[model samples]
Target chain A: MPVPDDRKQQPKTTADAKIPGAYEGETVTRRRFMTASAHTAGGIATAAFTLPALGMAFGPVFEKEQVRWEAVGPTEDFPDDTYIPRTITLSPGIGEVGKSTVYVRRYNDTIDSEVKDEYNDYVAITSRCMHLGCPVRYVEASERFICPCHGGVYDREGKVSGGPPVRPLDRFYTRVRDGIVEVGPRYSLNSELRRFSPRDPGQAIDGVGQYLYPSRPSIRKLPGT
Target chain B: MAKLPTTSGTRPRGTRAETTEAPATAPQRNKLQETGVSTIDWLDERTSLSAGARWMMFRKIPKGTNWFYTLGSATMFAFLSQAVTGVFLAMYYDPSATRAYESVRFLTNEVFLGEFVRGMHKWGSTVMVILIFLHMARTFFFGAYKYPRELNWVIGVVLLILTLAMSFTGYLLPFDQRSYWATTVGVAINGTGPLVGPYLSDFLRAGPEFGATTLARFYAIHMLLLPGIIAAMIGAHLYLVARLGTTAPPWIRAESSPELREDSK
Candidate 1:
């Protein structure tokens, strides 16, 4: 829509009111010059204070996920299809070595044909329960991981089978190189994997699962699927 | 400097009567009092600070303004205590999933007065919550949220929400088992909201799951964003409180209705 002639003339009217004797081509007045200078100074001042502070505050956020491959043990040491609890040292980007336990299970053959990594045969699930971070212990008789804090149970595939947990147990990225099993960073299970099969890479949570088990704000992408 | 005033009574030495009358030998007008008055006068002349001070300190609150009015001040005091202790804690806190728990442990076990400061920050938050609740309750019971003061009430509610957010975000900084799981649940709860729920949770946690980014985000919110918001809201709240004046208790207003009618007449 075209602007009305009167509305278009508003700036001219205000300029005339401010400087009655001056025309458009006249030299800038002291008041206008000072006003422009003041605005520039204000912008500079604001940027000077804000930019560095913002950088300092949000610097860590842009940092790439700091991951180092820590060897869990030899692949031959783990029997096929059995959960072995092992402690892994995680650095997590900060200059601190943190120890956490992961339940490592080695499959005899290729778990997925799509991803051709030899390490895909292993699954390293964090011991931290999905419900409340309590250490979940594997119950051999029940064939499940049971949380002591809230009775949350995860099946052998780390899918939540019963009680309280909104999602499956968190899993770490695993790799096997030259006969040794090593784990990288830990990642939460996507919603598709809540009832995941041992063979599936697990779908990323979308649609109803997005509503059911919302994905946590993660530094890294979903590892497996 | 001359000797300070010996008497600690409410009677200030520069009373209008004493300044004007000046009885034969007024004990040299206490040189210390003279200096204090002159200093205040100088400031008053330059900046009119006395008017601002009077505006702030000499408001005529309703006769029914009792000890309940102190709740707001108590909440402000608690917030200040938290800020001071939080600053000290921030000096040693590492807002990373890897170092957060360890740093807290070090503060508690190693740093001088670190445990005490942490305890103060924790308890101060509890006290702030309690005081803000009591203050809100008192405001509601007195019908202080009516008409002219409605905006102030709304700002108070916002402040209350921000205070809770501060507490919740601060809860995860310890990065313990309890904090981690509780935060997980909290983020999941955020995801339960309609439309933006998942996005909001992801935004808050900084990605798809709680980790280093989540810790950094919470730390920034708890330490900087929330505090800055609360402070601005508090300024607005106080300005509104001063502009509108506090409400008298309903009973007192009812009892004084006759006097108010007569004065109007």
Candidate 2:
């Protein structure tokens, strides 16, 4: 046979070079061809099985904004300066609809004098305790919220007053629109008082220091504390 | 063509003689065979899958390895069983504290084959744990962790830890009273550790106590984190095993040892 062109071609380390007759003519057998097609089909089927599962597992990450002002009826529904505990159905996100008890207290006077605006008009405190997740009961007579799980106590303003709670009671975002009151998502007090001093117990409410210490007379505290 | 010899008397009743005969249409058969061959060639050009498969399946293994060597493979089989069944069970398992119990009830009572899948996931986990322990014992007794296999041994230990973590986290996903109390105790036990114990316990619970966040955190770890870690470790362990080849049994090692021979002499 005549010498083929590129007879002195450089050595190829590619997979094609290693596989016999991989680049040669008439290399595939019927069985081998079917097997290869089956393999490709199997891979596609596996991806089909897994990709949807992965998407579903991570579906919450792509969910629309969960915190929105959901109307809780007219302003008359919540009397001025009175703590009214109401169970409101909240749709926080897609496929997440649930009822939550919120203590709505409307004050003609600003509850916290420092921040003046819509917050002065109303406050909606979530029943969920800041310590553990036990629902806090509003003790109207005591003007406080007490957690049955840990004896955590929060004042009317939702500030941590006693028990095991490390921080104040969590509050829901609230707004007054067209003589109607609406509540949004619950948020921790930690972010609002992030700039407060950690050392001083008095500044605990102003700072996030309250979150650092277990509630006073806490049975759960370490030995040194 | 010459007829091949056959035991005519032993032939099954009603069996067609044409089963042994050639295809009626030789040209069609030839065309079909040609198409198959070309398809394989087309695939082989793009991917060296056949070469890789041949290397994997036909690699030389030392003689006298025997069926005892199958424990590790059995353990791998159990792990795969757990993964597949766990995926199916996850479809109906709600991670929320309030809904989790209800969801599990729905899965077991209402959904078709959900109970079977759940049972498989539960029992597969138990089987995986047992198999891993047995495999480890076998490896230890055979002295397979020696020399070049040390890293694989370490990786195996890491896989064991991850597997245990997976089991522990999965225990809490059911949101039953038993799971709740058990997990609380588990978290409390972690809290008893020195220094970082409290912080670690808090992190695991996602707070000071077990509740919704605890359930969510445990669900995440069980379903995602531990599986990911275990998978990577398993890959490394298998790669090392393939690279080093399965270690010979202790008797074989002792028989081959020059020092042992010299001592005997």
Candidate 3:
């Protein structure tokens, strides 16, 4: 559409508004150029703003699968008591690495005959807190794991009792191959290898494998009048 | 010069135009020595830039104001410091069972400046955490969080939480015994919430329990995720600080002296 003669005849502002330049015929306005430049800059700014988040949000989606573990301990030597604090070194992926300690507790209990299998007679747990990560201390007096930072407490079975921790303690995979005990990746109840194979009855160990303690009989035989 | 036309359609046929110019009415002008107010007008017309605006939006800041503010800036510096160090570490960090431990060993022993840089980054995180909290406390005690500054306080709160989360997430990256157990407790706590507890726990670990996936998830979150959020929050915080203007010294408002009032009067 052609502009009307009267309106089209009006003088226009130049790109630099403060100074008026003489134009014999047509002229441009400062506002028009500013608007165009601003739009272009805005487009550039918007792209700059959105690209980084997009890159970070999607970059790791197709990363390779990694699964590995460090040997925590041998089976028979750990004894039937709580495993003390110790770090296990492992390489999880090509360049990835980690160190973790295994907490295992074994006590005297009769094994059910129905679930007997060849694995091992032991249970191990990892002590990492699920909340804002804090070292959880196993309080012997309370028989619960307690994190001092946020006061997160867990029951003897590693179940959450209180505080900000978000989940139960993780358990490591344990098995007896030959006589040596080894722990695999931390496993759960729903893992592919179902529940750990049950152990045989204590009597099946045959007395040869049992170690007799001098304190046992002496402690029982208190001084008599 | 050409004679001016009275009208194109109706002009007088005969003589040249006469100058009746209204006798150039005597000009009325003020000449009362000018009051020397020319100085004031001249000053106004000069259009010199206000020092405050010039100093604020540009100009090099003095060393004095730069002193205490360095704590916050240093806290930011430490974060960048951590990022550089962390990147170096991520190059060697393994988020799995097999390589996680070895990679840490390589970082600690094999890589150049690896141990020192990692230690600095680790310690820097602690310092950053402490400084951020201190900055918040300073802002609070100084009443910097009052009035128009409330949004800054709220953003500060979010940043505080992000800092703690960063620390928590970073703790697990080492995959140490302490981290493992700490993360377990972390997971268990999430499990205790109403409704989606179990699902949240599973989701956090990326499975039914902590595994290779959990380690990977945590590494990504710590290294790549939370930092991004923190950077945004910091940018907002600094921008707000710039907009709100720094809190002034209280003595400026006390106004106790009568002489001062009289002087102003």
On the 0 to 100 scale, the lDDT of residue B2 in model 1 is 26
Error of 2 at B169 (Å): 0.4
lDDT tens readout by residue for model 2, B1-265: 1121232455674343444343576967876785676567556546866776666676777766888899988989998888888888888888887788899999999999988889988888898999999999999998899998898999999888888888889888887767865675566455444444445565675543343455777888898878878888888887788778887776764356655565544
Better of 2 and 3 by lDDT: 2
- Model 1 DockQ, alpha carbons vs. true complex: 0.21
User: Which candidate number maximizes TM-score?
Assistant: 1
Q: Relative to the true structure, how large is the alpha-carbon lDDT of every model?
A: 0.71, 0.67, 0.58
Candidate 1 per-residue C-alpha lDDT over A73-92 given as tens digits, one digit per residue, 9 for 90 to 100 = 99877765668999876544
Best-to-worst lDDT order:
1, 2, 3
- Ordered from best to worst TM-score, the candidate numbers read 1, 2, 3
Candidate 3 residue lDDT tens string, A1-225: 987677544335442333456344335555667899999999999989799866544333323223343455565556554445556543333222235455675433442111223333555666555454455777778878887777788776666788765455555555666655666555322112233211111101113211210111101111220
- Can you give the DockQ of every candidate in the order shown? 0.21, 0.04, 0.05
Worst 10 residues of 2 chain A by lDDT: A194-203
What class would a CAPRI assessor give candidate 2's docking? incorrect
Q: 2 or 3, which is superior by TM-score?
A: 2
Encode model 1's per-residue lDDT on B1-265: one tens digit a residue: 2222322346665543244333556646766566677676655656877677777787888877789889998999899899889988999999877778989999988999999999999888998999999999999988999999888888999999999999889888898877876776677566566555655665676544354567888998999889999988888988888878888888784455555666644
Clashing pairs in 1: A216-B208, A216-B209, A217-B207, A217-B208, A217-B209, A218-B207, A218-B208, A218-B209
Count of backbone clashes, every candidate in sequence: 8, 6, 52
